[model samples]
Target: MNGGDPPFAQRIAQVSESHTTRIFTRAQQMRARGRDIISLAVGEPDFDTPAPILHATARALADGRTRYGPVAGEPGLRERLAAGFEGFSADRILVTNGAKQALFSLFQVLCDSGDEVILPRPCWVSFTEQIQLAGARPVLVDTDAGFQLDPDRIAKAVTPRTRAILINSPNNPTGAVYGADALAAVAAIAAEQRVWLIADEAYHVFTYGDRPHVPVLGLSPAPDGVITVRSFSKQFNMTGFRIGYVAAAPSVIQALTRLQSHTTGNVCTFAQYGALAALEMDPALIDRRRVALRRRRDLALGLARALFTCAGAQGAFYIFADVSAHLRAGQSSADLALRLLDAAGVAVVPGEAFHGPGHIRISYGCDSATLGRAFARIKEGIKEGL
Candidate 1:
């Protein structure tokens, strides 16, 4: 090997590591050194996996479900997932390790060299990197001041190379939920442009207030080119279970299944059983969590608004606040994030990670008391000119 040469594939150079995970790891390291750290970096639910899921997974293991399974998914689980959407059948669903993997596989199967996928900014941290990993380019369109999608901007950004338009509702960092009209417009653009529409609804069930989540597939005469990706992690507290599925046309599902067959075969067999149990969980349980999170969102937003200009977080448990006011001269949001971690004992993902600079994403997924204390420290840190 030549001195100072890069060892990994050249494609690795096109992407960056997830800043959310990096901040999370740094927080863990700080905690290991006995420093008090409150992390609002990763978007994991603070609750445990519901008991019924645990019991079902145990039973599945006891029944010897440890062996290989169908590449598409466990038949029963696929059927149940498909049943959630009108006019969809099991053949249209492809369960994968998580929504992340489903998206990765989708990009791989759909993209070619120089293809482009249009998405609004600031989006989740992984979307851009995932697009680059697939040898496609990520075309980022700016949302309005309220972080709502502008279909006209998306339409303007489209070109011959555009292969897909990816959207997230009850979005990750900004928590902007797209209403049906806006979603339909984007879908129409995709249809007219002959491009695919991929909707990442991982936080679909997490919306609050009157902003009910509108499933992209639930549109009247649902768009045929649409792909919906959902996860069990956020809603059911199944992050470790790594169970998520993609619902699309049967042809798309077949292509993903062919790709997954050469990749991880099936999602963990027993985990799918647990996911099956999650589908049967009490609706009230999820409602209770949503209610609690709404309270936390209010508390966190109140605190954050006092510190910085904030986005209108209509859904999801995040407050994407502009911390540029708190930053020192020449300091980026990343620098401010690190300073907050080292000085304030609070960890937040910097805005640059999500293509939204001069801001930071604060997750309200922690307990109420912890969240209160973390914001208290952050307020003090800003007062001290951090």
Candidate 2:
């Protein structure tokens, strides 16, 4: 073989780095150079992890639970998670490093070459890449104008090779929470068409106003071929804990366990104890945080609407604002994001990353004061067109 040949696997070329993280890294570099930067890019809660959960994790560490754990996760954590969902037993749960790993493993176990997974546009950036990494294709469907699920469009996108349909409620990037009817219709499509329905409920607990998040598995006469993936990250402000779990039929759980055994083995041992404590945490504490986030959402949304046309976020903590008005003819959201970063001293992710090219996603996950300051800078930067 010629030394001139590239040495990477062809599959490695199929995916790109996460645009969100790229923007974050760039912001960090700028900050190191003494530029003041306020980041509204990454979607992570600003709150600290609860004291009870921290104490439990510290206890686990003190007890020397740092060794490798069961491949599927600790029994106590799995049992607690399974108990929350109807018909799920501990055997049906498989914990992983995060919801991301749970998803990657699911794709690896579920997809063969050339298979397709249907995703609604403006999805989390990793969905497309993860599907690609599994040697599967991601078939993207555009959501309705309001960024809500259009089951009809999804139904038309299905073909014989279709493998699964993934839905994220209280969706990322666009903070649109999917309606129950649309979710049920999509579920019906999956069941009737014999495809897997994967629900990524990472932000399920963060909804606002009259719109509460609906779990796909909670549907009465619950549809078959459903898998629910959830995380401890959002609920407990435990993002660094790296603990998330999947609930599916026991066969699927066993298959995932087999795949994970080869990959990450088990989730971190002490972290599982922390996750267990998260479940036992007081409902009032989570409610308090949700209330606070709702207020921040209002503050961010008001600032966002003053600049660009965007729907009021019903869930999650992002405002996906259409910045097309600020772009010159032929300019993209990526350019606008970069201009905002340099000119406004604010960091945001471009819509192109989520397949919504005319917008940018601004996270409201930071404190209220920081969010307000960032948006003010964005306004002035756009006005000056620096």
Candidate 3:
């Protein structure tokens, strides 16, 4: 407090401002000033919410399906979500506002004060923050050169206080998908150590190449303590609907449900209908969308590689480029990111936000024309010593 009174909860102070939202807000302010900026920093898919989902939600509202519903999620939506994961049924699914909430709840359910959660480096920024929010320490393990998991490193990080090992396949920023062997190795370690294997499959639908996205729970010698989280945001372009679900052991699901009852309560009751519609969507839409993302990935990667030696991205819609050579004196990745946003009218994320300095993240969720223009500006900016 300003005077000699108590201040806000010190716990919240432990949370850092989200650098991605900070950059996003700045880009928005610049746009309000009439700048024709091309934003390559946003994480959401650029596609509008699909028609079937929108129609289903509209029908839901029209049919008066809008009261408070079950805290664990409506049975229909939970049943549909549960069907996708092996060994899970409706009783084992707890739908939350988004995958983000599901993750936060998982940490709360599993972690205690001073407990540790091992997260791979250059992982999603929220994972660390959420672990802290649950009064736990996050032990970050650096990945191998390709941004893939180093199971050996993760294995070494475990201690008696370790509560979970969190992995995001097709990892954010770097876009490297961990193969089946890598996942199985990690699961084995979790099982042997009796630690929870937290699998984030938010980008499961966006994996590229012949190797498909594998759910860690399905791998051989499956751990009884696996917790898998997925969302409708990326796959169905339902960002605003705020619907996602978690599949875990029935006991874990019950704990999440009880915690959620006193916490966020049920996700918007009618929004569940939209999620229901998404599960039944034509499989081809996903295929076509992935093909389009592959094209953008190729286009953006080619441009980024010309200036910096960036390897090909395997999945997700981001290209992480090492820009160490382009930095002026004393400039961190965040500095270069803001500099380009100001000078080139283009927006990209700084790698330091992802615990990676000397690198920048470019989201290619926009159309080809926007990507072409943004890259052209970037090239010109580099030529001008920006």
Model 3: lDDT equals: 0.89
lDDT of 1: 0.92
Q: What is the lDDT of residue 147 in candidate 3?
A: 82
TM-score for each model: 0.98, 0.98, 0.97
What is the lDDT for 128 in model 2? 95
Task: Estimate, for each residue in 1-386, the C-alpha lDDT of model 1 and write its tens digit.
Answer: 56986588989877788999899999999999999899988798698889999999999999999999999999999999999998889999999999999999999999999999999999999999999999999999999998988999999999999999999998879988888888888888888888999999999999888588998776624466899999999999999999999999999999999999999998999999999999998899999999999998999999899889997588988889998877778989999999999999999999999999999999999999999899999989888877
lDDT of 2 by residue, 1-386 (tens): 67787688888887898899999999999999999999999888789999999999999999999998899999998999989987778998999998999999999999999999999988899999999999999999999888999999999999999999999988988999999999989998898899999999998889987588999877623454899999998888889999889999988999999999898898999999989988998899989999999999999999899999997389988899998898988899999999999888899999999989999999998999999899889888878876
Give residue 92's error in model 2 in angstroms: 1.1
Using lDDT, give the best candidate's number: 1
How many Å off is the CA of 116 in candidate 3? 0.4
Residue-wise C-alpha lDDT for candidate 3, range 1-386, written one tens digit per residue: 56787877988999988889999999999999999889999988788888999999999999999999999999999998888876678998999999999999999989999999999988787888999999999999998777888899999999999999998977788888888888899999999899999999899999878467888988837556898889999888988899888888899999999999999898998889988998998999989999999999888888889987675278988888999999999989899999899999999999988888899999999999999999999999999998
Instruction: Give the residue spans of candidate 2 off by over 4 A.
Output: 1-6, 220-222
Local distance difference test scores for all models: 0.92, 0.91, 0.89
